[model samples]
Target: MADFAWSLGSPSLRLGVTGLSRAGKTVFITALIHNLTHGGRLPMFEPWRAGRLLGADIRPQLHPDVPTFDYRGHVRKLTDARVWPDSTRQISELRLTIAYESATFLGRSLGRGKLDLDIVDYPGEWLLDLPLLSKDYRAFSSETLERGREPRRTAIAADWLAHTSGVDPLGPADDEAAGRLHELFAAYLGAARGGSLALSMVPPGRFLMPGDLAGSPALTFAPLDLPESGEAPRDSLWALMESRFEAYKDVVVRPFFRTHFARLDRQVVLVDVLAALNGGREALVDLEMALGEILGCFRPGRSSWLGQVLTRRIDRILFAATKADHLHHASHDRLELILRRLTDRAIARASFSGAEVDVKALAAVRATREATVRRNGESLPCILGVPQEGELLDDHLYDGKEEIALFPGDLPDNPQALFRPPEAGEPGFDALRFLRFRPPPLEVTAEGVSLSLPHIRLDRALDFLIGDRLA
Candidate 1:
């Protein structure tokens, strides 16, 4: 056992998890906790493979005021009900005490290695709010409006764009006017997020997740058409929107940042790249833009002893392409390549900050198995799993009970090919099929011990994110 005096003084690394809605934040956390505590197969995680990792156990909440993550409840749903856990609706916390053996003789002389891992889960939709701190209302409005004018967004942003184009920023401020304009803008944001469009650049994030501030005036402001060089008249429409916008930054975003986000030592941004691909190239571009902006907000760098005393900076950031089990094993590398290329720019910026950055394709929990099927005269690689009911693919709608094999199309080996437009009749990404899969039943050993959740490259994710700390 480690001595409490010295061991307790060791700093705990808080890992923040966030991404777009349905990007699997909740599921990822659930799997992380489940795997660590249960001794899941993790050959790539050095501490585990070296036989230095002992075990992990849930600990008391570090912040008692925050709601605790429902790890047990989520496990029951995945193991018993055979379904995916729900997405993150609000900020939640989980703390783990990781016990291990020291790799170094000096560390062994002191005591065994142990660490407190504080995990923070929050809605990714609201993540873009962090950047609002540096942006003035005019800059925000300009950027937002410019994006709305893009070819793909033009139709979805029609009503709000038309209304804002006519708004007189110098007009007298009226509560009713503000409410109406904001309603239209919020509708456009809703439409942008709805169904298959799946655009990720939707900001004024509070508009999407307004918890208690749903109808408050602070949330009732929308971007307006204003001149670039002059200020609007005092107490004008622009003034109202600007004040509320600032209030959003000060009253809402800042507290969350100071309390939770700024304190993180590591972060994992889960991306449902497959969903974005299914939405089309426009969605992919928007996803890239959103990810880049979100990454820009992270104060990433090496966390030295002095730096730790002065301020906290995320020293490591992992960008994971989730739902890897949807494709055959042969296509895993291609998917990872596509993700790295997709976020290549963001990865470059983060890396320049002196932080270790990497991208991996993972499924947290594997819900499918690979198989080879003979079609006509050739052998085709496919994945077998139970599709969610009513899911239509290749003209067959699944009934949610029967297992089926799907031939996921191949991805370009050349990552650059994704950035370029395809020929008129050419199809690669657009031809692939990605289907939703139910959680697979756990396999039991002869002694009745159920195996830990199966996954694709999740061990690599663990190795990259926190393996060094364990060492």
Candidate 2:
């Protein structure tokens, strides 16, 4: 049965990744695939040398029904900016075919098989709807209302909270009061989404696209609200609230999961814990709650017993805190702490539920270096980083401070906390101050290119997802 199950007709791995908008999925996938194709330098795995013909040739997927991604094109655009244009909107899917040769147990070579890897990219907006799967109006409204109190979101919350106060929490959900709240919620999302108005996943383009919607509506929403006024009980309001919550789950939540979530081989969940830390206690609480709820979708805790017994587990889950390039090298530890705290709830869920999870605080791209400058008798940490687009100050003169050697702990949510700059500069303040990510130089030798740690990380992640079949 095990051999039969591992046959070519069966999928060796099914990894799923979920992250908020601007979380760096495209780059991670692109780099992982790029390194896989050129695995000479990678640890433990033999590269696909030209003459050796390891038997695995990455071809465009031959699935007649599913769409194939231009993996090479995206890679070129990411590596060579002069080629394909940058991606601006959410692409439907990026699928690739990875075929390779692995040693067989019988001391004889096994037939070459294909690995169909699919990565579906969608908006983060839809992710916010998952909690609704198990929530009612009062629960949803109150939560959204409470979340509105954050300093960054106070401006938007003022309008919806005021309107919610007039409605009877117990009144029918579709009552005039309920209707007003619904519209306000939608409007708030629209404003948060640059008036996309549709309650789907807000894509990364909204944040990094450079078009409109940069500092948009903040995508703020209240969880269910309790009756603020001591009015008579109105049960209809509860009914209305429940119905809308259901509508949100069915219309928005289910489709994304069915289409995108269910098709992966490995998964990564990105959290912006630094922003939450900067936002303070309320933001932290909200971040924790959001992380918990989002992780619930992938855990076996909610799976049916049959699913737990039969379906493949989401073997490797990488909870990465993105935008690591924002901070200097010294404070990477504190960033890890902040991230661990923020994700403790989800980590607990995965741990108790039997899923293998790795929490990493990475910048996906190393943006800046910790350099030093000596002023007077004291030395301070300064950033010697270049920007992604803009030109950096061109000066080779050193002020004694060289980039500090920082071995980042696991990736963190609050990258800023882990930042220990050699010297303070006004420019490198937040996530916005990141240097463009450059791939580590390929180590070449007499044989071919060699593998590095990043390449190993990808290999292990892949192995966990489907090593048995690949081997």
Top candidate, metric lDDT: 1
Q: Please list the C-alpha lDDT of all candidates, in the order they appear.
A: 0.83, 0.49
List the lowest-lDDT window of 10 residues for candidate 2. 195-204
What's the TM for model 2?
0.63
Candidate with top TM-score is 1
Score residue 123 of candidate 2 by CA lDDT.
44
Score residue 329 of candidate 2 by CA lDDT.
53
Candidate 2 shows a clash count of 62
lDDT of 2 by residue, 52-145 (tens): 2243334444334444445667766645452222432443444455675545545225556566665554544455555555565555555666
lDDT of 2 at 311: 42
Enumerate residue pairs that collide in model 1: none
